[model samples]
Target: MAIGDSVKPAAFQYHAPQSVEEAVQLLGMFASDDGRIIAGGQSLIPTMALRMARPSHLIDINGVGELEKLSVSDSVLSIGACIRHAAFHRPVVGNPLGGLLSFVVKHIAHYPIRMRGTFCGSLAHADPSSEWALTAVTLGATMIAESLRGRRELHADEFFVSIMATNLAEDELLVETRFSLLTPGTRFGFYEFSRRAGDYAVAMALVTFELVGGLIADVRVGVGGAEDRPRRLPEAEKVLTGHPPSARLFEDAAAAAAAAVDPMEDQQADAAYRRDLVAVVTRRALERAAA
Candidate 1:
């Protein structure tokens, strides 16, 4: 049988490639013909099932062993495309970044979803409410996109374009993401508001900062689910940096976050409600970090 002949195809063809080079070649051939790369399929499968996405070919990358790499090297945590969310249940490295990932991974839907969903897949999906995406933007992670053409590295700020969208080209696959390990004694916090336990977040915040001489330094505040994409809040960071952690300062930072964002409005939440949620989540995250 040919590569995709076994599966009874209604409209799409499936190809499983065992190596990264093979997959890239297939993508180069089929991307213009609506070929998509499937890893964990946490989001893509459902969309296909509902007939929302009608790709003619799916190049499954789960069999690509090279894409399953997860390691810490050169003071950075590198997560490969096939590394599932469950891998982060325990600290993957002996650093604050590992602990922070462990804490945030639990909020990524329920247990079963975590078992199959890949970290790189989440970033590729680019959901605004995704916990991993928020963490990536907040931590200044670098995304590596590969293809038959070439390889390119993108910072989190430039990688994500909007909800369920990214700057990745049609023929490119997200191969790996590198997150710099947090320094020792760094403080971090994350909080989100959702309608139910496993529902997508309505609004969320991830905050990190270091203290020097009892004053905050290197502060980063990221807000998500309230905007088109997860992004660091410079206005909020400005309020927190160089200041001692206090309830008043946290409140001010939260206010700045709320003021800075132009929130998304939908059936679940109006713009004003989302703005309020931004303030609440931002304040709560900052409080948790300070504590």
Candidate 2:
């Protein structure tokens, strides 16, 4: 069925620009009103179908040149806004942050959706259960957004405001995301729970740590699907940061993370259940990270 068939709305303007500059100008021109930028059309299309978003103008950015490049530099990996989830799973990418991100992307929604769901699209969509957002936050990534006015950068912690909310301006477009290169001693792990394999996560955990001389030197932990936005577990990280990776440390970190989150009771799971799941998955991920 057609999108308009599902959600009846008046036809609006559609423009597919060939360059980022052109798109920026178009956005500037329509900045006064309800204008939406469409990249992969994965999230926006569905929202439009459901009548949740009805923009007066649709600015398509797919044709913009060089927005799909995935480049790895000496200290960072820069992923363009248009890079799809499938691109992330390519072996040639040589992602050193463990297979956690690739595993999550490979299972997101299904093959058909993964084929079209762009990396930035998922970030921009800012769904609480989105693996891309969780992974980025866990890795201490940066998001780049641009507009006719200028450009701005946001750390993963500052980028996501709430569920389905972001720090992006209405006229700005997310152009790239940069992830720090994993150090040689860094260890990584990810875990998520859901009713089905391809379904959105009910609770997810990501952990990155470094082992120096058999001791934990640094640690970062992030959890998703348990709150309105993905969040780092600073208390949990502290519990593991300077200590040896032991069963006791993992347990303490998990308990700290569970106490830190404020999950809401939804149809998927109760608040208490999510809090418990956070502890469980945090422990599991920490175990894997320390292995």
Candidate 3:
């Protein structure tokens, strides 16, 4: 037990599954009690210690090294369930995903937390304010999940249903998430506001754009921490795509983004304040991408 953490988790059986097949079988067997999968344990352990989560069996998949797969195939990136955030922070030359990953990983938490945290763990956790989750939504990433029954793929929009919620089945393990590489001319910008460094963002904006003949050929805007789920701001994107970039247009798009999501009041910030932050970040992100 760590010092100052006196609260103990409820006693539970543990299973270290060595293969995806074995993991799914155990997951299916424990569906009655709702088995919990632990990947870095950054979120799971805390929830368990708080007595907020008590699973009959804890399935630790770290032993299944196949889940640690990380490779670039055909210029697209496929990140496995067990790949640590620290691996994504490494310097890689001429890789767009690596560049974006490094930027996002730096904002996740402290170095030790990054060292231990898995990218897929955060994706499965489905935290609305997670930088990775926000980026996944912006990238329109694909999720691969496997169960004893079979395997299925999910798009980012289809996977995240709400805050702390996902389409992942109880008996399925998230195997990998695939991300498309941005084209050569793509311009991107990511920004967020938190009370302090390493703290969860109160409001965040991620933008990507491609210019053709001095007009926006493609554009995407994703807002996080202000609503129940990460989402692309279609209204905002509509304002930019096929139009020439302008400060006035960006201002309008920012307003559209603030209107796109219904943020709720919380101790961290009120609905009105979050909406204002959303506008500010969205405008800045769009401007940055245009620049």
lDDT of 3 by residue, 106-225 (tens): 888778888988999999999889889999999999999999889999999998998899999888889999988888788887888899889888999999888899998778899999
Please identify model 3 stretches exceeding 4 Å from their true place.
1-6, 91-93
Kindly list the per-residue Cα lDDT of model 2 for residues 34-72, writing each as its tens digit.
Answer: 887888888788777667888889898888877977887
How close is each model in CA RMSD to the real structure? Answer: 3.3, 2.1, 2.2
Clashing pairs in 2: none
Worst window of 10 by summed lDDT in candidate 3: 91-100
Determine which window of 10 residues in candidate 1 has minimal summed lDDT: 2-11
Q: Work out the TM-score per prediction.
A: 0.96, 0.93, 0.95
Which residue runs of candidate 1 sit more than 4 Å off their true CA positions? 1-10
Best-matching candidate per TM-score: 1
lDDT of 2: 0.85
lDDT of each: 0.94, 0.85, 0.88
Which whole-number lDDT from 0 to 100 does residue 18 have in model 3?
97
Q: How close is candidate 3 to the true structure, as a TM-score?
A: 0.95
